[model samples]
Target: MKKQFNRMRQLASQTVGRAEKTEVLSDDLLQIERRMELVRLVSHNTHKRLVSCLQGQVGTDSEKRHKKLPLLALCQTMQDGGAQLGDESLIGKMMEVCGQAETTLASELMEHELQIERDILEPLYQLAEVDIPNILKQRKQLSKLVLDYDSARTRWYQATKSSNQAMAAKVDSLKDEMEEALNKVEICKDQLSADMYNFSSKDSDYASYYLTLLESQADYHRKSLAALETAIPNIQLQQGQMGGPTTPPPPITPLNSPARELTSTPPPQRNGSVYLTAGTPHSQGGSRGPSPHLMRRGRSSLHVPLKGDPRGRPRIRWEDDISKLALGRLGIPQDEVSSLLELFPSRPDS
Candidate 1:
């Protein structure tokens, strides 16, 4: 209880002395403390905001099975939707490539955020929560000790000036207390000054950490830009096709159309031969060839009676392919092909 009262008294005295501008804090130390306090406040808030951004940009593990950036999630959704639309769809193809680019961007962004957390946010947090706070606590302890030393000195001086000799022992004890308090104040002041100088020395390092963050941010934007630049032209090309003309399909012909009959008519026969004249035979008449009755039959017209064999006896011979010659002349139906063959006897060579 006595210790608590003394602590309260010392705090009150220190507060009054500081307010009256009589506490006499070192100018450099005061400036360092003030700057450290600001750093702690700003950095702590920055850390909080960065963490919040991470949670929002990339969902927490509990919120998402595989913590994905918001854009990554969107890209995945687009990719799946594109696949569902099938390979031939133009929009589907564009979505496929766009989603791939966005996926790459999302991955890069996630990497950047993680790097920031590691290099910037984590260090800021340490400065705010640990390093600066420890230094400030030491400053506060030093302030209290200074107040205690002052109080001890005042008491010792009063005891020495006492008109009563009976107070000599009390004076000696008070002087001892004053000396011990001064020793503590000197020690704490030395430690606080050292910490302030150390903090000041690290100022450049803090600045460079922010520069590193900027570099990371610039690299991230470059990647994102490259991805978008590649995607935009393809998307534009697809967009341009929206109103262009399409080729019409070829005309379809009916299976039994007259046009087919016209096409089926044999082109005028050449040199009195049908498909081939290699083994064709001719009769004695040469030009007159087969009789009119046989000539009337398109299949028989294919036969040319040539001069007889060396023996001079007349012979009949037709093209090796009887069906081809008949069918090639008239558009003979497939079902009548067998009947036409029976009309022309098989060659003896068969």
Candidate 2:
């Protein structure tokens, strides 16, 4: 009975030891699973953050630089009239920002992924050392974990590829937009230059025309003043001659008197014409009337002067004689001179 009791106690002690060792193994497995879960949560959070950053929710150096680049370029364009702005500066800044963000995110993701892998491997090693059955069961779980990890890794890789592709596309789009804007600016500059040139040309033409008009007006006024100056002296001389007074005349001489010859003879009444008496031997007949030839001759010799020449002013001669003038000057032939003179009478000056 004593041997059997001792055997039973030893058996219970062995069973208790076995239970304790199993409990310890279970605890270690649970710890390892908890650690793996923690690692998964940490990795997931990091991946979520990285995705958010890639999706533009979390700002990175690339995002900040992209946001600031347009504003900086706009300010520069405004300040310098678009002349000093360039695409090189903007593109360089964009590349720098993308590189920085990529490096930082890649480093962080790799570190977290490595840590999770190490943690999962540690549990796998411990399970191998313990119960072979537990290790086998955990191997199945580990295979699932590996699949999940592979899925996560694939997602990360796909996300990285998509992010890089999106970034490249965005950069290309921005470059195209910038190039179009620059072309518009250049067109505006050319238009402004053309307008300025036209305005300057018009102003110069107007100035020249105005100066020409002024010179023409000045010349006209100068000619008018000269004509007035020449006419002033002639007007003054005419005024002086008209301002003088009139004069009286003298009486006739005694030898030219008519009353002394009529006392020696009685006058006889003849026909209507007057007849002069002749002395004794010189006269053919005292009763004969005046000769008809003498009367005709006296009538033909009578001359009448022009009405304005009552005081008998001397005639003013022209430089050339009208009768002896050439046909070209007189505008008529010598044979036709009488008819031309009848049509247009010759003036005393001509």
Candidate 3:
């Protein structure tokens, strides 16, 4: 009985020792699980703190990458330092470091983008509002100036037209007056020719007297021819000296001075009028008489009088008539006659 009791006691003691060993193993496992849980909690808290710091210090890119990380994986990484680490505390420190680095890089990139926008966009907007509007207003003002210039040019053209028309009207009026005066000159020339023809029909007793008158008339014509010849060189010399037209020579007087024997006879009466002799007595007792034959032939021969010589019969004033005709026909002002004559070629006397 003693031996059986000793065996059972030994078995019971062995069983009790095994159970206590199992309980101690179970307690160590629970303590280990609690330690792991604490490590995980501590790692998760550290990662969250790191992430929050990155969000505040850095910017969006880190937050976006962090959102992709699984909560369990992130926790495991935090507790173990990395996938290679079995230590929880080390893993937690590594995860916090990675989150902080990502935040810093994102913050630098955002700042760079902000600086680029400031450099490029701000000046462009200002140019659009201020410079572009000023350019448009300048173009509009130039258009208005062009329009005003065209209007002023049109007015200048109108004024020039009106002035030209007035000048033309005055010229036409001057032309009409000239034409009327020319007609009167022609009538005077015709009457002088008729009177000369009537005087040529007188008797032969007047032939000797008419012959002397012819000689005197021929002498006067010769003098006129000589004077005309002398005038040509004088005019050229004067024009060369003055570089312009010269003033016209004064008109010569045409009063006749007969010889002493021709002036002594009395005057005759014919056709109910007293006919003065070719040479007749002057009031100073100077003899002046023109013979009967002289009177008839002289009337026939004398075609025109000299200029400014009204003392002679009006029939002989052909040069005076020509000046009047030139004034009437050519529309030259009387004051400008000397200048107009300069344009004519010098003529030879017949």
Clashes found in each candidate (C-alpha, N, C closer than 3 A): 6, 0, 23
> Where is model 3 poorest over a 10-residue stretch in terms of lDDT?
18-27
**Residue-wise lDDT of candidate 1 within 216-247, one digit each (tens)?**
88987898888789877776676557542345
The stretch of ten residues in a row with the least summed lDDT in candidate 2 is: 271-280
Ranked candidates (lDDT, high to low): 1, 3, 2
Q: For candidate 3, what is the TM-score?
A: 0.20
lDDT for model 2: 0.39
Of candidate 1, the 10-residue stretch with the lowest lDDT total is 271-280
What digit string (tens of lDDT, one per residue) describes model 2 on residues 1-350?
Answer: 64345334444544566311111123444454444444445534544453433322222344453344433344343434323433244433333433333344333333333333334323333333333333344444443333333333333434546657765455545455445544544454344334334433453543443355345446545654555465555544543454522243555645555665665454542321221122233355444433445444422332212335445433333112332443444344454543322332122531
Better of 1 and 2 by lDDT: 1
Q: Write the per-residue lDDT of candidate 3 for residues 1-350, one digit (tens) a residue.
A: 64345334444544566311111123443443344344335434543443343223223354454443344244444434544553244433345545344333344434433332343223333333443344344434433333333333333434545557764555544444334433433443334333223323332422333254345445545654565466556545644454554566765533443454476564432221122233566789885655546554433342333334545455325435534654565443444543333322322333
Off by over 4 Å in 3: 1-95, 159-350
Best by lDDT: 1
**Model 1 CA deviation exceeding 4 Å by range:** 7-24, 51-66, 164-166, 229-350
Ranking by TM-score: 1, 3, 2
Candidate-wise lDDT, in order: 0.68, 0.39, 0.40
- The list of candidate 2 runs beyond 4 A from truth reads 1-173, 195-214, 230-234, 241-350
Candidate 2 clashing pairs, residues 3+ apart or interchain:
none
